[model samples]
Target: MLQAKMKNGQLITLIHLSKKEVEEIKSRGEEFYCPECSQPVLVKSGIKVISHFAHFAEKNCSLAENGEGAYHESGKIQLYNWLKKQRYEVQLEAFIPSIVQRPDILLTLYDKKIAIEYQCAQVPIEIIQNRNRGYLNAGIIPIWILGANKFIRISQNRFKLTPFLTQFLHQFSSSYPLLLLYFCPITSQFVKIQNIILTGSGQAFGSLSVKKLYHSAFPSLFSVDNYHEALTYRYWKREKEAFRQNVRGKLYGEELAWHKWLYERGTHYEYLPSSIHLPVKDQYRMKLPPWNWQSRLLMDILHPLSKGHVFSIHKAKYSLKKYYSPSVHFPLIHSHGEPILQYLHLLERLGYLTSISDTHFRKQMIFPFYTNVEEAVKGDRRLLEVLESKI
Candidate 1:
């Protein structure tokens, strides 16, 4: 939307133009056309708004629902300037003909090409996926940097990570950890959240760090090695306590259904063993909440087996196939490993199970239910002591 083609097939960008030049463009009486659709467009420039070209309201273009506000415009310019000052090969609103798309800022570093998209508004998930697929298919990596307004921070270790927000999580390379980036144009501050681990719907545990734009470089995003994984464990400990207390309130949907199942088995939330509702590093890929599926596996399979009986990971996952979300749920995560193994390994460390092989686990000690909430809290405290040491 920033670059348009003249009638003579010459491309013009308004990013580095002066107000006098913009006034002359308005008086030049020359026609400008959109690069993507080749349709006539009008130049919009004023004191309040940034200089750019817009397609007519009646026309439909893929780039129409993009970078509309001066906030979006100003942020892209700052980021482009930052990269340019670092002596990196960067372009503003670079259009790719093969993909029929234009990224906000495209940076070509070394042998790799990265398309940086500065997003300030909410859009459909399918649109995000389609754009990512297009960039990936063209051998380019797409990094989506969300606006500061899009980030809802609950605390130092807590984040309200809705599905729309999670769609923007970026894994720069296979060796790097997962992270989400946010920039506040007004404040000139950058917020980086690394080692993001989803615990439940719309909630996660991560290490959040903030830095000014001028003090940071491109490699800082990937190489910042210092973070407190202990904070993640602390957040999980609090969530487990809250999970135990939720049964005192009115339950609905999956929670209500799970309560009914517990009633038939003569068990309640406070009576559940410490193993239930524990955290897994990749709970985002599962359709059911941790308690529902973990409880089901314990009651239906693991709890009924003899102490020496062994179970295969294949058989366990097959029995609870409906609880797992497809691998496509998390497009940004490159390495897809089963989350159940983490839970099993945790149980193994806590003396409930033993690893017989890479794919099989043998039952070691049977799990026990608590008689009261206080006793359950004690069990959690004891279990988390070992869990924290291992983490």
Candidate 2:
């Protein structure tokens, strides 16, 4: 809707046109057509809304049916102009011939091609994945920036990760935690929620960095920040306490099943070892919450053997598969790596286990058990120290 083709096949954006120019073009009877479907479109210059093109009511264009509203139009234009100001070769709503997709803004950085999509409205998850795959197949890195208005702030440092936003999380490297990007055109601010470690299925604790659009360069988007060790542990401790007190709250859905499985194993939620529910950066990959799979790993894989028990990570991964499911749909997430292995590595580094072979580890010590939140926080503090060292 931002850019349309004129009768002469030249592309023009209504946002860049002056009111007088729009009036002159309308008076002269110049016609514009949808760039996606190549159907005639009408130019609307409204006082309340930004100038843009739209298809007629009877038209069945897919783009028109999607309804790119004023906010999306403005955001798209703002991003295109922002990238253009940096002297990057950029295109607005450029149609990709190979995939027949029109990315909002396409940028050519040296030899790299990037497609920036400023999604303001709710879209089907399948469609989003398809678009991402299309760009990936074309050798274009697709960067999805969410609308800042979509963020539901829960606290100073935490925000609600809606199902829609969860799919867009980017994990560039296994070492780098999941990161989210949000832009508010109204405030002209870009919010980068980086190094996010989810505390629960729906809640996350992370570093939120906000910068003005004009002040930040492109490379800043990919930069990861150190998560405050004390702040992160403080929040995790509270979550652990809540989990401890709220047994009834979790008696539903998959959690109920997990609890039943624990009951069969002669252990309950509160009695699990302190290390079971601690923060694991790569825990996002597992379907069950941290307590379930982490506890299962302790009970089934790590706790059954004597002190001399040596096991391979591959065996642990295979044993944990029933509890494992892809929780997030981030394409950049390393699919081949096991999140449980990462947790096992942390345990190894903490001196509870020792690496005896490339993929096998020897149990050095027994799992430490804690009776209260205070003891749990101490265990979490030790784990947090290992996590912070990676930063």
Candidate 3:
């Protein structure tokens, strides 16, 4: 195992230390139990790594993997030590019998007890709700510290939250203020904290400023409120509408025409479907390009039709006319060519086609033209018959 460097100029390895060495550290009174599971930890000795403690398990612990939970455990230890330095009466991994839940850290200030949950992964809403109930039943304040990239607090009466954020909020009502802490893995630090005000449904409705707590290095106070106007609900509605419009705008017109072309020719021609595997001449192969960031981006921007589904060009055009001016149609047509080229290249490379540059030979196509016709027909037998006659 790798060794960590300690501030005391001692290198500590993860290997088991002797009983005498463990006793020597305990004599110093620096030893502590795991806050979460009450497991004993002892400092190990090594030259290359700094001195650090490891849990002394009577039996092997399952949470020994090098992952987010392990990091959270380590962070909890560091945080507990830091809090102790500040003279706060704190308990690590304190279990509350009333709630049947264990909090990462519990701090008692006079009569008030606070339960802090350090979440490093996506936890279920039911779990959070049960835990929240447990803490509230125990007359303790529950605080959740989420991992960075999990959420962000936008403004008063308007916050942008994720599914995970929604789940966390749904379990606990608007009783306690939610503090959104952004954890930075690169710097190994808690970068910032935003105070989140939640709605009745547990959605984050707004945010407040943070007050730096530890010598401008840690946040001490953050407050968020003023979400009574249902602004977040309105903002979310508008955002969803805007996204729909953007998607439609990117995919309409000439792009619609390319989709129509695929729909009409897909079955007779061996066209590859988008992001699915289909049978080629003798074996199954990918119909569309592999799903990747760049390809997805291109698909979003270009709106190419999938070989698995046919595009109804006339219907799409009519729909576009209902919402857009005729002058804006052609630009969408010109934008889809790049994604088409990309699709064609992918198909050729996957052995669905013979050549990347060759676009004329219909037999080289992988998708059956019938897929597009199914889309164009849209459950109308007459339309199917008409399309079939044309083919």
* Cα lDDT, all candidates: 0.83, 0.78, 0.41
Tell me each candidate's TM-score. 0.93, 0.88, 0.40
Per-residue CA lDDT of model 2 for 301-325, tens digit only, reads 8998789789988888887787665
Clashing pairs in 2: none
Residues 298-341, model 1: lDDT tens digits: 88889999999999988788878988877665666677667787
Clash count list over all predictions: 0, 0, 27
lDDT accuracy of residue 321 in candidate 1? 91
TM-score-superior candidate, 1 or 3: 1
Q: Write the per-residue lDDT of candidate 3 for residues 1-391, one digit (tens) a residue.
A: 1222344534443323555574575478663543334455565444533244556654353222222444555555555666677888887655566665657789897898987666776655555666666677678877666554454445443555553564333112234333455443323455332333322122343443432224432224333334432332343333323222333445454445544654564332122223221111101011121222222322332234432333332333333233222321211111212223343334444433344233321124333222453332232233223323432
What would you estimate as the lDDT of candidate 3? Answer: 0.41
> For residue 78, what is the lDDT in candidate 3?
55
Candidate 1 regions exceeding 4 Å error are 173-175, 246-252
Candidate that would win on TM-score: 1
**Cα deviation in Å at residue 252, candidate 2?**
2.8
Among residues 3 or more apart in sequence or in different chains, the pairs in candidate 1 whose N, CA or C atoms overlap within 3 Å are none
Q: Give each prediction's root-mean-square deviation over alpha carbons.
A: 2.0, 3.1, 19.7
